[model samples]
Each structure stands twice: as structure tokens, then as C-alpha cells.
Target chain A: MENPYLPYPVRIDEIITETEDKNLKTYKLVFLNTDDEEKFIFQAGQFAELSIAGQGEIPIGIASSPSEKGFLKFTVNKVGRVTTHLHNMTVGDIMGVRGPLGNYYPWDRMEGKNVVIIGGGFAFTTLRSSIIYMLHPKNRSRFKDIHVIYGARTPGMLLYRDELTEWEKRDDIYMHITVDATDDPDWKYHIGFVPTITDQKAPEGNADTYAIVCGPPIMIKFTQPVLDKLKYSHENIIMSLEMRMKCGIGICGRCNIGTEYVCKDGPVFTLDQLNRMPKEY
Target chain B: MNVIKIDKKTWTEGIGRLQGFYRLIGPVKDGDFYQFKALEKGESPDFSMLNTRLSPKSIIYPQSEVMFEYSLDETRDDCHVIKEIQVEYSPQVVFGIRPCDAKAFLLVQRNFETPEYKDPYWIRLYETTALIGLACNTPCSTCFCVDAGSGPFNDAGLDILLIDAGEYYYARVNTAKGEKILKDSGWSEETETKDAELAIENLKQAAENRITARISTDRLKEKGVPDLFNAPFWEDVAFACINCGTCTYVCPTCWCFDIQDEVRGTDGVRMRNWDSCMYPLFTLHGSGHNPRDAKTKRLRQRFMHKLKYYVDKYNDGIQCVGCGRCINLCPVNIDIRKICEAMNGFEPEQKSI
Candidate 1:
């Protein structure tokens, strides 16, 4: 059997700082071996374990769409050792990546249905991938109206600013950006928390509508009720959770909440599924 | 199945003959307790003890095992490439093992050898090992293996089961490996006496009957996850736990691990070490959030995973084999039997302040 622990080598082709504090950076990586690239097919909302060989490995959500061929993108926040080491690296520096792990959003099931995406702070990476995938020319006609409600603590903390600007001009999707509170003169978006903005701007929930939400624990805890009040069934409100993981193959045993191994069973779950699991995560 | 008898005087000679063909491992005196270790030449297992302090899981899944080795020397053509270290998988015998400990390996195998992924290191080691279990003639005060899907003479995972018959040993061979070892050892004296088999069965029943302890697992699966998560008794259960990680390390079924890369100048080895859920660092996220940060949460996780979650997931009784190593080794005297009964009997409708 192939060793799941061994990571394939990749090199950074481009790096984009997404936040003012320079805490978050989006790296565009190209696999050193073309065979690895061909084998690493992934869907939106799935994650991969990025490693620095000596430093360690950490799970990061894949931030680019599967439709975008050739390169893979990961938006990493400089929170711990591995990310700090990765942030210090420049283009051409080698790193290791293993996966396309965990279950992804149910995109195939949402075909011809209205899509509602709620994102908060740096947690928007996977949602960004989903948006890009749903908006792609080949996939656009399969989905109906797309509504995006995204927010950050401040205007400067928002990620993918250029893409947000481009998305705001697109006629195919509706985009609403916000900040908790901002005084920047260039700020042209609403100023409030995600749940409040979601309550006011999100489309009325229906049987044909599917909602995907990702954020910090507090944001998710509060957003669930807002989605509930909007009449979204527990089965339709999807969420992506964050947990400390190792092996990403489900053997190390840290990401278990009840009997579910988040690395293998999910980083994504429906509200109905979450209701059945222990609240450890 | 085959039954053979070996006189007490010839047991050492039989072991000596087997050692010539395979490496021998068994329990031996270690300070104040017994431990499973590789037997040197002329050494015999000390079968006087009820059980070993630490489990024999390390034989198959070592506490720290190297998975890959790589060199950083740029001049070498294979530099920076990780090569799997060649491991010796010669046939070996784990003699004088407790039946419960042997059964624990089968439970752990469910995690390591799944259809989607198999741990080559663990699988390879397990495949080459033949377990020779010593039936418990004297049940310990803490032993509850009878309640955990195993018993004094359970032959679920053992290749051979040896019962002490005072003046001699009655060995029951359960597999081809066991028969081969017995035949090679030249101890294959067939016992045609029906009284010997009757005596072994009587002794097994008496030993099992001596174990008066039991834990209720009847209601564990019926309880809701949230009710158990929010149970008010967690603080009481977690109060005495110091998070020493002794229980996990000594457990026969606990299989959590942490992987790290070790570098010594030009060479690097990626290794995995045994990790415990009792530690705060086990679930610490890179983003400064820990889901099981509090001691109560960590303590709750351990029990819930073993008694409730494992039962629900595998539909196999529980993750615990009930060897009672944790009960014996715990500094605070935290008993799993009590916790299991508490969880199994927990009523969500009754609120406790």
C-alpha cells in the first residue's frame, strides 16, 4: 500500500498577502512532479496538509477551484510554527503537500438550486473556491442565483480584495461584503457582524436553496440560528469545521468528535449531522 | 484444535528448543512489577504475576517507530528523498501473554488495517507475531475482562492458550502456527485423558466466577450525545485526574499517536510517538483554539470515546479490553468500571446541580 504519510514536493510559484498585518498569505503551488498534479484532483471545501519537512505539517483548506487547472492555492494564516515557517519562504522554495482530504461541499446535489454562501474573516478561503467553481463558464448554467454574504473584523482584514471587486461587477452573482466596524475612507461595504448582515441580506430559505457557512466558532454558533430563523432546514445548512489534525488520513486520532474522524469523515457537515455529534469541536 | 501436555520440569527445555527457531518475548521481573521484554539466552518468563504493568502492544506498535529516513547531503543523488527503512519481520513468539492483552490487538487492528488505508508498519509486525497466551488462574481484584467481551481463557486472538495444571501445563493449539511451534519445540505429547480437559474447563469457570465485578453497558448506546456531553457529573469525574498520561500509555487498546520529524545534521527520520488525549496539547489547533482545552472536556473525551463512541461506531462492546492496567496504574485511583456504570446508567431527564 502507498504510504499516506509521505507528502509530495511542491514549490511556490506566487505568494499574495491577503491581510494588512501580513498574517494571511495565499500561495500558488506547482507540483514538482506532473504525476502528482494529475493525481491530486480535489473539490471545493476540501483541505490538504502542508508541510515544511523539518518544521511540521498543518491542515489548510484549499482556496482555489478544481476547475482552475495547473496550480493549487492555499490561504494560510501565520498562527503557529508551520505557517510561520511557510510565510518566511519565497517563490521557488520547496514545501510538501499531502491530500485533497475530507469531504467537500455537495455541489452536485445543489445543481439548478439557489446557493447561499456565508463566510466570516479568514474562513472564506474554501467558500472562495466554491464561488469560483460555481461561477466558472462551464458550470455557471447548472446553478441558479448565487448570493454571497462575507465579512471580516475590519476592511483591511478582508481577503481576496481584488477578486471581491471583480465579483461585485459580475451580473451572474450577487455579492455583499461587510466589516464589523470600519472608518476607512475607501470602505464601500456595510459595517456589521456576519450573522446580522446575513439576517438582513440572505435570500429567504426554501426547499430549492442550499446554504454553506464557514467561520470561527462564535460566528458559526450565531449564524446557525440566523439560518434557522430564515426557515433553512437543518439538512440544507452546511458547515465546515476546524480541528487540529495529523496524518490527515484518520489514524493519528486527534480530530475525533464522538465517533466521527473529521479528517476522514468531514471538515464539512450538515446542521443535521452536527446535531447528532458531540459538541467537543 | 490439539491438546498437549508438558511436565513442569521440561518446560524450560521446551522453551529453549523453540528459541532456536524464533525470537522469544515474555514477561519478566522489572523492579517492583513485571514487564514484557525480549528474553535473553537462558531466561524464562516469570509467570507468578497476574499481569504486566505495561501492555505488550509495543511489540507490534512500538511507542516510537521510525517510518522514513532521508539524507540532506546535496552531493548524494538520493539526497532529500525519503526511503522507507528496512524492518526485520522475522517470525517471533509472544509467550505468556494475558488473553485480554492479546484480544486488545484485534480491536486495535480495526483502526490500522482499514479498506481505504493500511498502516504497513503495524500490519507487518502483527502478521509475523504468534501470540501464546497464559490463561488467568487467579483473577486480579481490578480485572474485569469478563465484562469487556473477553475472559480468563478467551482464545479470540491467541494462537495458543496455555492453562496451568499444577504439576504440568495443558496447551490448547488453536492455529497452524501454534501446532508448528509445539511440534518444533518437541513438546508434543498428546494427552488422551478426558479428565484433563474436564479439569481445565472447571478451573476456567472457577477463575471467571471469582471475578465479581461488572459494569453496565446496556444504556450507553441509547443515550444522546448532547446529554452525555452536558452531564453535570463531569466535574466530579475529572477532579482527581492530573493528566499524567499513565492510563493511556498503560492501556492495551488506546492507539492515539503524534508524528514528528527528527533531524541529526545531515540525516532526518520521521517518527510517530504514542500520544494521549489527556494532554492539552493533543487537540491544540494552530489558530490558538483547543476544543478539549479544559481538563473536564479531555477527561470526558477519554471515557466517552471508549465506552460510548466506540460501542456506537464499531457495534463491538467497547474499546476497553478490561485488562485493568489503568485501574492498577492510576495514581488517583480513578476506576473505569465506576465511570462505565455511571455512563451506562446516566439519565438525561434527571438534572443534577
Candidate 2:
């Protein structure tokens, strides 16, 4: 039997400071063993425990799409001890990545449906992965129309700026980028909160359209009403929950919401499912 | 099943002979209280005590266990690489364990050995240790095992169930492991199968009838999850909880843990220690958000997990064996029996105009 607590060794290949504040940095890691790399099959919206020796481990979402190969990417915010230690490390530093833990977004249900990706602030990591995954040439035909409404506190705080620009030029997918309030006169994007932009630009929700929302609690709380007003059924709205987790495989028992272990049963649950559970998270 | 009639005089000799084959862990007297500890040379288990202060869960899952060890020194060939620690999973015999504590293992097993993922650490240790249960002829006043899906003489998780009948022990071997241990211990005095079976049944019935305290769990499965979660009686039920985590520590089914890395210079070991839901840090998010922030919320979670959540998830009995260690140890006298009664009888109030 595989030891669920054990982590696979990975060496840091590159590190990119994503936002201007330098709180967020994306690490590109390569598995030390070829066999280990082959074993790590993952999907968008799933997270992994990044193990830093002598420090600890933190659960971070996998920011890289499965279609993108040879390396795994994790966009970490330098908030706690393990992340702080991660920020000070240099390239080629060896650490460990424990999983492709937690369930992914409902891809089986989303297939052949129009996907509306709504994201805000630093939570755009997995959304970026989803956007890249859907835009892949092989996967592009799996879905119909794709719309993305991404927002941030400021223009500098937006993640994957270069990729956003490239995506904006593509006619295959729609990109509506916004900021809370930016004073920069050179900024060309819309100025509004994510919910406002989502209300203005997202496609009319129906049985055929699914909106996957990932953001801070405030953003999610406000955006839900907008999606509901837009005729989105409870089941059509997908969300990813945040919780303090250890043993990402769910045995450690801290990340539970009701009987469901967020690390195993979810991190991704629909609004319909959330309504049945305690509003604890 | 192998039935043996061993005189009380030979019991110590049998245990001593078996100690050479397996590590002996049993309840030993410890200054007005009994504790489960490894038997040193010439030591034997004291069966006079009702039960140990703490559950024998530590024998399978320790209070703190090292998962891996590593070195931070770059001079070494394997610097920064975490390696799995060498754990000695030697065969062990937990002798004289109460039947209620033995049954607690079965409840905890569902969490560790699920269909999708099996916990390697828990499964390995549990598989190696054979439980030798001493049927509780006289249960404690706080014990409510009868209604909590376990009985004083429950043999759900035991390899052997030993019943003291006057001068000899009626050994009921329930598994091959039990028979092997009994045979290897040089205890081969056979008893008539009919006589042994009848005596065990009578002892089991009398012992069960001695338990007067009872808690209702029949209605627990029928209660809705959200209705029970938002019940109004939680305030009174959780009023005296000081969040000391004593209830969770003494609970055999409370298998929650927290993992951390401890460092001494260049050497580091990643270990997991028993964690409780009552602690504020248990659910505090990194971004300064706490879902279960209040004392009432934390207290509610512990009961909800054990009573409502476990019932909803497994559809089995609650995640408890009615060991009553928590009841005996709680400084505030926070009783699970009362909380279970409230939950079992909970009904949402009708809104008035």
C-alpha cells in the first residue's frame, strides 16, 4: 500500500513573483524521478500539500493544467510559515509535493456545456489553469462558448497579465478583465468589482451554461446573488471552498465540513450542495 | 473456536511465556489509577481495575508519531530530501483490555481503512497487535455501552475474550490469532464446548444488565443534518465546555491529528500528534479566517462529528464505544450522554407570527 503521508520529491526549476506586492510567487517544480511524475495525474481545481523540510507543509492549488507537461506549477501566497520559508528559497531547492489531492471541478458535467469562468484576486490560479485547459486545441471542441470574467484589486495585482493579454486577442474565447478601482490613466480595462463585471458580461445562465466561481469569501458572497438573478440554477453554479487542511488525503480530519472532508469530498462543491451543509465554511 | 479453562495460578505464567514472542502491553496500577503500559520483565497485568484512565488507542496509534526525517545540511548526499523513518511494527499483545475499549477500535477502523485510501501507519500497527479483552463483569457507573452500540462484554474488535469465572478463566478464542497466542503460551487445558458457551452467555447477560445508564441513539439516524446542526439546545449543552480538549484526548474514536516538523540543528523529523476539534487553531485558516471561531461552534463540532456526522457518513452507530473516559475525565462534567439525549429528541421550533 502507498503511504499517503509520504510526499514525492520535486526540485524548483523557476520562481516568478506574480503580483507587484510580491506576496504571491509561482514556483515551477520538476519531479526528481520520472516514475513519480507519471504517477501524479491531476486535473484543474485540485490542490496539493507543498512540503518544506524543517518547516512544514501547506495546501496550495495546482496552478498548472494537466495538458501542460513536464512540470507542475503552484502559485503560493507568502502568508504563513511554510509559505514564508518557500518565498526565501532559491531555484533548484528540493522540496516535496504530496498530492493531486481533493476532487476537481465537475468536468464530466461541464462537457458540451458553455463554461463561464469567474475569478477574483489571487484565487485565479486554478481558474487560469481551467482557462488554459479549455483553450487547448484538443480540449477546445469538448465545450461550446467559453467566457471569462477575471478581476483584481488593481491592474498590478492581476495574475498572468501577459497570458491575459494573449487570451484577449483570441476570438475563440471571451475575456472581460476588470479592477476594483484603478487610477492609472493608461489602463484600458473596465473599472468595477467582479460581481458588476460578471453581471454585465457573463452569458445568460441556463441548463446549458455552467459558471465556475473561485474567489475570496466576500467576492463569492456578492457574486452568488448576481448569478442567481441571471437565472443560474443552484446546481449550475460551481464553487471551490477554502479550509485549513493537513494530510490532504483526508485522514488527518481537520478539513471537514459536516461529514465531508474538504480535502477528499471537496474543495469544489456546487451552491446546491453547500446549501444542504452547515454554513460553517 | 478454541475453548480453554486456565487456572488463575497459571495465568501469570502463560502471560510471561507469551511475552517472549510478542511485546506485552496491559493495564498496570499507577497510584490510585490504572494505565496501559508495556509490561517489563517479571511484570503482569492487573485485571482488578475497571479500565485504564486512557484508552489503549496509543498502542496502535501513538500520541505522537514520526512520519519522516530529513537533514538540512547541504554537505550530505541527501540534503533537503525527506526520507521515511524506520518504524518497528513488531507484534504486540494488548492484554486485559476492556471489551468497550476493544470495540472502539472497530469504530476508528472505518476512518483509517477506507475504500479509496488506507492509512499505512494505522493499518500496519493495528494489524500487528492482537487485542486480548477482559469482559467487563462490573461496568462503571458512567458507562452507557448498552445503548451506544457496544456492551460490557462486546467482542467486536477482540481476538480473545477472557471471562473470569471463580477460580479459572473461560477463554473464548474468536480468531486464529487468539488461538495461536493461546497455544503458543502453553495453555492447552480444554473445556467442554457446551459448558464454556453457556457460562460465557450467562456472564455476558449478567454483566450487560449491570449497566444502568443508557443513551438513546435510535432517533439520531432519523434527524436531518441541517436541523440538528442549527438546533437551539447547543447553547446549554456546550455552556460549561472550557475547551480543555480532555474529552477528545480520552476518546478512543477521536483520531484527529496534526502534523508538524520539529528541528534540532540540521536534523528534522515530520511528526503527527493527536489534535482536538475544540482547539481554536484546529480550523483557523491561514488568511485569518476561522469557520468555527466561537466556543459553542467548536463544542458543537465535536458532538456533531461523533453523533450526527458519523451516523450520516457510515450509517453505522455513532463514532464512540461508550468507554465513558471522557465523562470521567471532563473537569466541567460535560456529559456526552445528555448531549446525545438532546440530539436524539431534538425538534425544530415552529415559527410564530
Candidate 3:
């Protein structure tokens, strides 16, 4: 019986300020022990509890793909006390990461299908993980096609700028990056909300296609209809939910939408699954 | 399945003997009501009360438990590293517990000891303790254990069931743990199996007959969740609730918690405290978005979770064991039985032109 509450120690390797407001930062962490890294097996769309010594723990999506070896990445928003402490900490500072918690994207069902990623603003962390995962050379051949419709309030608020730029030049994956109302003259991408771009650029739904959507509730709420209008069935739309979580193993009991504990049974659910549950979330 | 007859004169001696081998906890009169507390040396568990005010769940999952301790001094060897603290899992006995309260542990154990993950703190304490239940000879006004998959003499959760026989007690050993306790306490007065069974059955029937409250759960499993969630009666149910959180605190099946860090200079301990859904902060997100923002939503969540969600998830009857602690302790007189009836009988309103 292993202790699920115990967190593995990691040291902050690098921190990158993501947005213009300085509210979001991507922290690259390396495990203090090689054994800990070997034990931390995770997939895209899963999350972890980032623990601070005297401040509390917060559940954040794991932004790094497992294909990228050596370190784990978490793009944390400076909204609460623990995250604010993490934002103020310097490199080489030690912290705790306690997961690989929650379910991940349906890669088993998603094999040999087109993946359309719809994301907006700060909710793009795990989407970034999924994109990087699908783009890896060894993994690219397993999927048919990849299309991304991502947006932010402005060009300055978009995350993973360097990766998005490099992805734009790739012929293998179709990338349609957009900003709500950007005035930057150098911006060559689309100019609209995610739902609008998704409507215009997303592939027509078929049995061979699946869409993974993660974003603000407003973005998800609006993107759902566009995907539906494109003839995507309820089972093909995958979503990640947000809830205030304590013990990521589901014992804490606060993150339930219905009988399902989002920390254990989900964070990832198909629209078909969510339809059967209460709309409280 | 062993029955031993113990005289009332030797009950205190047996308790004192058991105390030497294990930590003893049971209901004792505190101020105006009874509560479960650890018995000190030479102290015996008082067994005359109908029920305790607070549940004995705190014995397994303490209200506030420290999980880890750390030092922020940077000069210390374990600086900045949150290390799991050493916890004691000593053998214990909960003597004279109600059958309903003991049954709550079984319902709550499903959450902590799931197939995927197990809570070491809760599991360890629960496994090491022996539950000695005192069968209800007189049912309380608020008690409705029969409808909740439990009864006055329910042995589902207890290791041993003790039947009060006026001048003596019939200790019906239900598990290996119960037998061990009897052996350790040196109580070897054996009773006829058929005779003890007949006597216990008669007592159980009379006590159950005294319960008049009925909770209908037949339609709870079949009701549309969205219709129940959006029911108009929720407003009436939540109208008087002050969100004081007394209902959750006194509930044995409510297991939600909040983790925090308390600091004393350079030393700190990370602990988890009991949290309530009745509070606005329970479901509030870090991004200033709260799904359960209003008290109506929170109140709905509490009932839906206990009566509907738990029923659907485990296909067990309900998360509650019908202990009636919440009914007795709630300041606003909110009753779960009434809410359960509304949900079980709810039908969506029809739209008209």
C-alpha cells in the first residue's frame, strides 16, 4: 500500500513568463531523484498537485509531454496564494509534485483518427501537451491528421509562442492560431474567437475524426455548438473539466459533478458522458 | 458467531481489563449531551445514552490531521522538503457504539479504500480498531435506520453486537476481531446459540417497531438528475439555511476536507481539516469562478450527493446510515428525511401554451 498523498521532490529548473500580464508562468522542473522520475509515468490531459511547503497545494494540468524526457512542466496562473508563492520563487528552489492524477485523453479510441484541438487563453496548457504528444515523430504516424484552433484575448496573452511559431511552419499539422482582436501588424494568423475559427477551419466531422476541447467555460460553451453544427457526434467531443481539488486521489470528495469524482473518474469526459450527468459543472 | 453472557456486575471489570490492552473510546456525558471521547485510566464507557451528539468518525479521520511537516529555514537539513510525518496506528476499541454510527464507517470506506487508490491514514486506523456496537433497545424520534439499509441490530459494520438483557449483556461476536477482544478480556460465559438468537430477534423486532419515520428511495435511482437538480423545491429547502455548516460537521458520511499549512517561525505542518459544501469557499475556483455559488446550489449538492450520487455510484442504498445526527444538531431544523421525500417523489413541471 503506497501513500498516495506523498509528493515527490522536484527542483525548479527554469521559469518562463507566458503572458503580458505576468499572471501565467511555465515552470520546468527536474526530479530530485532519478527514481522519482522513473515512477512518475503520465500522459497528456492528466494533472498533478503542486505542493508548496508552508503555502497549500493546487491542482494544475501537466503541460509537458511524456515524450519530452528529463523534466516536467507546469504552466501555473498566479491567482491564488500557493501559485503566487510559486511565481515568486527562484530557480533551484525545491517543491513537490504529487501525481499523474486523473484520466487522460482517449488515445486508445483516438488512434488512427484525426485530432482537432480547440483551446483558448490560459486553458491551453494541456492542449499544448496533447499537441506536442501527437506531433512527436514516433507518434505522428499513428494519427491521421491534426488541426488546432487556438485563441487568446490578444497576441501577448497566447501561451507557448515559440512552439506555436515552429508548428505553423510544419506541413504535417494544420495550425490556425488566432487572437480576439489583435492590432499587431506582424500577426499573420486568423483574427477571431476560437469558435469562429473552429467553424471555418475545423474539418467536417465524420466517424474517423475526434475533437478535444479545453478552455474557459465560455469558450467551451460556445465551441460546443460549432462542433455540433459541423456534424460531430456527442461521443467524439472530449473535454477536460475544472474543479477545486484537494487530495487528487478522489478521497477529499469535493470535485464531483455527479457520482463521478473529477479527480479520479475524470478531468477528461466525452460529451456523451457529460450528457448523462448533472449540468452543475 | 459466538454468544457470551456477561453479568452487569462484571461489565466495569471487563472494560477495565480491555483498557489495559487497547485504547478505549465510547460515549460519555459531556455538558448537556453525550459525545464519544477517549476513556482515561480507571474510566468506563457510559452506555446509558440513546446516542452521541457527534459521530465517532473523528476516531478514524480526525477533524484536523497533520499529514506532513517541513522547515523553511533553508539552514535545516530537511528544509523546503515536505516530509510525511510519523503517524501512530495503535489498536483501539470503540465500545458501546450505535449500530447506525458503526455502519457509517462501511459507507465512507468505499471512498477512502477504492480500487485505484487507498487513503493510508483512514484505512490504517479503521483496520486496527474493533467496533463493539450497543444495539438500540429504544429507537429515538429522529432515527430512521431501517429505511437506510440499516437497523437497530444491524451487524453489517460492527465487529460485535451487544444486546442489553437488563441484568446482563449478550455479546454476539460477529468477526475474528470481536472474538479476539472477548478472549483478551477473559469473558468466557457461553450462552445457548438458539436461545440467544431467539432473545436477540425479539428485542430487534420491538425496537424497529418503535421507528415511525419512513424515507422513500425507490424512485431516487430512476429520477432524472437534471430535473432533480433544477427542482423548484430547492429554494424552499434552502430558504432557512444559514450555511452555518453544522449539518456537515455532525455527519459521519461527509468526508470532504481542506488542506492548509500552519507555520510557527521556520517550522510548519501541512494539515487537512474537515470542510463543508455549505460554505461558499468549498467549490470556488482559483479563477474566481464558483459552480456552486449560491446557497441553493450548495444545499442541492449536499442532498444530491448523499441521496442520489452515492446511490448511483456504489449502487448502495445511500451515503447515510440514518444516524439522525444532522437532524438533531441542525440549528435551522433542516431535515434530510424531508428532502429525500421531495427528491424521491419529484416530477418535472409541464410547459403549457
Candidate 4:
């Protein structure tokens, strides 16, 4: 029997360097063995523990949708040791990845609902996976007016800037971008925090919408009141959570917020679910 | 080497057969407390009361355990730390381990003995220990192991189960190791009669009905959140909670832990320590934020996890033995019964295939 504990050695076919930020990069990956490709499966918003050669595993969300089956993808920020090693890898480098574990975004319920996506900083990576899955060719029409509000600290830190620009142009998406400080004139947009822009630019409280918020703790705290003022219910406000996870499983006993394992029970939860957990980070 | 019965008139011969074990642990009286203790003198263990002071979680998943040892045996130039583990111990016999606590060992053994994160320290203790499961003659208010599929005389993980049949114990050998011990002891068998069956039933009824409190977890399992999330009821139950985690520590099945490195000068050992979700730091990271900070939030977490999350994910509740040690030892008297009763309203939708 194959050990669930042992990670399958995977070959990194391609790497997509998005933005000039020293931290973030997106890798386009496929199984080395063709048979494994057909057998492989993962849900949007689920994560895998990826291992670089000579470095151990680090949990990163499945950045590409299950709909994009030809290749597996992950958008990682080189904040720690393993990621730093991953950032130095070339096309043919071999690494290890061990799951498609954790829950998925409620796409079945999310369909036809006016979705408002609020994101700030590198935390937007998991949200980006949800957006990609929702906008696929077969599923795009099922969703109502989609609004994506994204922000970063500075022009130097803004991830997916070109993609954000194209998204802003598309008639389908009601997209908005904000930066904490603008360094140059090339960027023509709001010059303020994401919460500030969110309170001002969003198409107000009239429609039925599920507000998907992801960002730094400071941004999440500030944005909660803006959403409350806009009359979004706690159940309707879904947010992504980040914790110091080691096993990325419920067994490690590390990610217990109250009793919920953030790695298994969440990484994505409703504000109502967050209300029940311990305040510890 | 078949089934054997020691005469109830002379139970000492049977106990004498277990004389060679380095440690003979049995339920003994300490003031008013009846707990698991080392039995240097051969005496019949006390089982007329409730469970022990601890749930036997420490024997396998110890509260404080050394993962490995680092040693330096040379002077000056040759003084470099060599990792070593003291993985040997004299075989021990534990007396009167409840069915719930015994079954909990099944869940705990998998993690420590597995290929991933092979904790040799814990595995050593497990290998050397022999369990003598005692039948629960009086189930307390906190027991729900029967709901988790363990009974008063459940022989799931034991080498031997000594069922209390009023006058004397009815011994049942479960594993090869236990059968070997019995075969080595000179004994003869009498056919299991109807009288023994009647005595067993009487013990079961006394254990269940004598305790005035009851919480039907089956109803809680069927009904999920409506009763559980009502903050007012949860607050009432947990109002006196001091967050001491005594209930969790005494709990035979609360297997949560924390890993830390103890550094003394240039040398250090990484150790895994017991932790409870009730604590503020159980979920706290170096970052200045916590999700389960307050008493109400922590209380909600404990109830929801045991009643819903574990069942939803693992297909079986990990809380194997419903040993009431947690309830008995909880300083605040925060009863799990009231909490489970309140949360037995929302039957969560079954997982879609």
C-alpha cells in the first residue's frame, strides 16, 4: 500500500513569476507520470504541503482550479526557508506535494449570488484561486455581477497587477484596485487603504451578496465594520484564515482554534464560524 | 493452554502468577480518592467506584515526553552531542483500566508508532506495559464510551478483561500475550454458566442507571447546531470555568499536545507537552491575535469539536472511552452533560457523496 505519509515526488514543469515583488511567484505544475495526471484531483481553496529538494514541506493552497486539469498550480510567497528554496528552482526541478486536503469554497451556493471579493496583500492568493475557478468557461454565466476589490502596501508590492488591469477592463467584473502609497505616475488609481476604498467604491447595500474577505489582520479588522455598515450578515461574510500550521492535518494538534483544526475544518470559514473560535493566532 | 478458571475461593494464586512484572498497578484507595496506583503488595483492586484520577493517556501519549536523547561521552575535542534514546523498560502490568480508557489506547498508538514522526519514546512505554481491563460496575455521570462503541466489559484492546461478577472476577483472556500468561499459570476452567451472565447484567445496570445524569449523544449527533450555538446556555454551563485544563488532563481521551524545545546553554531537547484548547495560547501564534481567546469561545469549541467535527471527519468519534475522570476532576464543576444536552438540536446534514 502507498503510504499516505510519504509525499509523491513531483516535477515542476513551469514557473510563472508574477509581479516584481521579491516574495511571490506562481508555479505551473504537472505530474511527471502521465497516469498520475489523470488520477490527480483537488478542489479550489484546498492546500497541499509542498517540499523542495533539500528543504521540507510547506502548505500552499491549490492556486489553480480543479477545472484546469492539465496542470496543477500554486502561488507561493517566499517568506520562509522552503519557499526561499522554491523561488530558486528552475523548470526541471523536483519537489514533493502531499494533498488536496481541506475544504473548498461553497461554489454551489456562491453561484448566482452577487459576489464581492475583498483582498489585501499576499493573503489574496487563495482568493485568486476561487476567482479563477468561478470565471472558468463553463461556470461564468452562473454567477451574478462579480466585484473584486484588491489592494497592497505599495506599487512595488502589488501582485497580479497586469491581471488586475485586464480584470478592470472586462465588462463582466466590477474590479477596483488601491495602494497604500503610490511611488510613480504609471499607476492611476485610488491612493488609500483597501478598507477606505471598499467603503467608498462598493455598489452599496441593495443587492444580495456574499462578501469574501481575505487580507492582513489589520485590513480584516478595519473592513469588518465597513461590511457591517453595508449590512452584510455575519453568515454571508466569508473570510480566509491563516495559522502557523505544521502537519496541515487535524492530527498535529497544532492548529486548534478552540477545537476546530484550521488546516482541516478551515482556512476558509464564515464570520459566524470565526465568532465561535479562540482569539489566538 | 485453553480457557482456565481460578477458584473464587482462592484468587491469590491467579494474582501471584502476575508477580514477576516490574510494576503492578491497580486501583487503590488514597484518602477518599480511588485511583491507579503501584501495587507492591498483592491485593484485589478496587472497582466499586468510578474511574481513576487519570485516563491512561499519559502512558502512551505522555503529558511530558522526551522525543530523543542527546549525549556527549568524551572530553574536550571529542565532546559532540550524540542523539540517544532510552527505549528499554521492565514490563509493567496496569490493573483495572476501564474499557473506555483501554480503547483510547487504540487511537493513541497509531500516531506514536507510525512511520511519520516515529516517536520511539512513547512506543517503548506502550510495548512494555500490560493492561488489566476492569469492568465498570458503576458508570458515572461523565461516561459515554458505550455511545462511542465501548461497553462495560469491552475487550477491544486488552490482553485480559476481568469482569466483576459480584462474588469474584470472571477473567477473559483476549490476546496471545494474555493467553500466554494464563497458560503459564496453573489453572483449570469451569463452563461459563448463566449465573455469571446475570451478575454481569446487574453490574451494567448499576453503572448506568445509578448515576442520575444522562446525555444522549446519539440525539446530539442527529441534531447538530441549534442547541450547540445558543450562547446563553453555553455561558451558563461554562460560567465558573477557570480554564485550568484539569478536566482535559484527567480526560482519558484528550490527546491534544504542544511541542517545544528546552534549551539549557548550548544543548537542548525538543519535547512534546500536553496542551488544551481551553488555554489562550493553544491556538496563539507569535502574531498578536487569537481566535479562541475567551471562555465562551473556548467552551463552544470543546463541545462542537467532540460532538460534530470529529464525527464528520473521522467517521468515528475519537473520544473512545467515556471515562468521567474529566468531569470528576474539573475544579469548576463545568459538566459536559448539560452542554451535550443543549447542543442536541441541530442534526447537521450528512456529508454529500
State candidate 4's TM-score. 0.65
**In CAPRI terms, where does candidate 3 land?**
medium
Tens digit of per-residue lDDT, candidate 4, span A160-242:
67777787788888888888987788888778998898898766644478888989889999999998898888888888777
* Reference-based TM-score of each model: 0.96, 0.99, 0.98, 0.65
Better of 1 and 2 by DockQ: 2
- TM-score of chain A, cand. 4: 0.93
Q: Which model is ahead, 1 or 3, in terms of TM-score?
A: 3
| Winner of 2 and 3 under DockQ | 2
Candidate 4: lDDT over CA atoms?
0.69
- Chain B TM, every candidate: 0.97, 0.98, 0.98, 0.81
Tens digits of lDDT, candidate 1, B1-353:
76788888889998999899999999999999999999998899899988998999999999999987877776776555556788778999999899999999999999898888888889999989999999999989888999998999899899999999899899988999998999888887789758768888999999999988787787888887778878888899999999998999999999999988888998888899999999999999877789999999998999988998888888888999889999988999999999998888888786422
Write model 1 residue lDDT over A1-281, tens digit each, in one string. 57888778888999999999999999999998999999899999999998766667899999999999989999999988788888998997777788989999998889999999999999999999999999999999999999999999998899999999999999999998999998788888899999999999999899899999999888988998899899999889899988999888788888998889999899999989988787778
lDDT of 4 by residue, B131-173 (tens): 8788777666567666666777677778788776655667777
* Residue B313 miss distance in model 2 (angstroms): 0.6
Docking quality (DockQ) of candidate 3: 0.69
Model 2 per-residue lDDT tens digits across residues A1-281: 68888899999999999999999999999999999999999999999999999999999999999999999999999898999999999899999999989999999999999999999999998998899999999999999999999999999999999999999999999999999998899999889999999999999999999999999999999999999899999999999998999888878888898988999999999999998888899
* lDDT (0 to 1) per candidate: 0.90, 0.92, 0.92, 0.69
Per-residue C-alpha lDDT of model 2 across residues B143-181, encoded as one tens digit per residue: 998888888877789999899998999888999999989
